[model samples]
Target: MSANANTTTLWRPTGPVELDLVRALDRRAWPPRLPDQPIFYPVLNEDYAIRIARDWNVKHSGAGFVTRFEVDTAFLARYPVRQVGGETILELWVPAQELDEFNAHIVGRIEVVHEFR
Candidate 1:
């Protein structure tokens, strides 16, 4: 894969995150691996991103946020894209230690698409 593959492919985080965490990720364009979280999830579509951030995340915590960004498709290829319920919703499960490398694969700034509180 090309070194710049991250520039062309898009990624979005899946799951509800705190407002502060969302803002922090936007500032850095990548997220640090949380302790014991084991997997870093990035979804394949806006619909899923919205669903998780709005429905699941907010329902669980009273706050949720979505961020869109680009990642190296090549690096992403190393991990499997999983389907939790059906084909419409898909996500990549990145290992924790590898999350840093995954962060490196990020191409640009992460922007918030939706926020709920």
Candidate 2:
């Protein structure tokens, strides 16, 4: 929706989401949560940028969504530092109507799942 430069919060890390989960990922993979095209975003390790696809996982999962699909050496290359750390934030490009349902599933992993819903 806007430039990736903004450090605004999508969803803040609070409680379990805030404490351990945000900083415990060795690797994370998400499905297409953005657009199909490429975009530039800053990383914690680099100053310039990296090219990322909005819907990068359409073929594998068959859904326009991001998942914790796997973790291998190759998988390490899929994310920018911004999206790294714990619970590597991902998306499942869906319609606005499905947000509530999807949010419910994710809540299962967090302490505030019920409050978030």
Query: What TM-score do all the candidates reach, one by one?
Result: 0.78, 0.18
Shift of residue 39 alpha carbon in model 1, Å: 0.4
The residue ranges of model 1 lying beyond 4 angstroms of the native Cα positions read: 1-19
Clashing pairs in 1: 6-71, 6-72
User: Where does the lowest 10-residue lDDT sum fall in candidate 2?
Assistant: 45-54
With candidate 2 superimposed using the best TM-score fit, by how many Å does residue 80's alpha carbon deviate from the native? 22
lDDT string, candidate 2, 2-116, tens digits = 1222221122212222223223532221122235424322222211111111133223232221112112223224443454433444422334344333333332122111121
The top-ranked prediction according to TM-score is 1
Q: Cα lDDT of all candidates, in order?
A: 0.68, 0.26
Instruction: Supply the TM-score for candidate 2.
Output: 0.18
lDDT of 1 by residue, 9-38 (tens): 444644444346656666454556668678
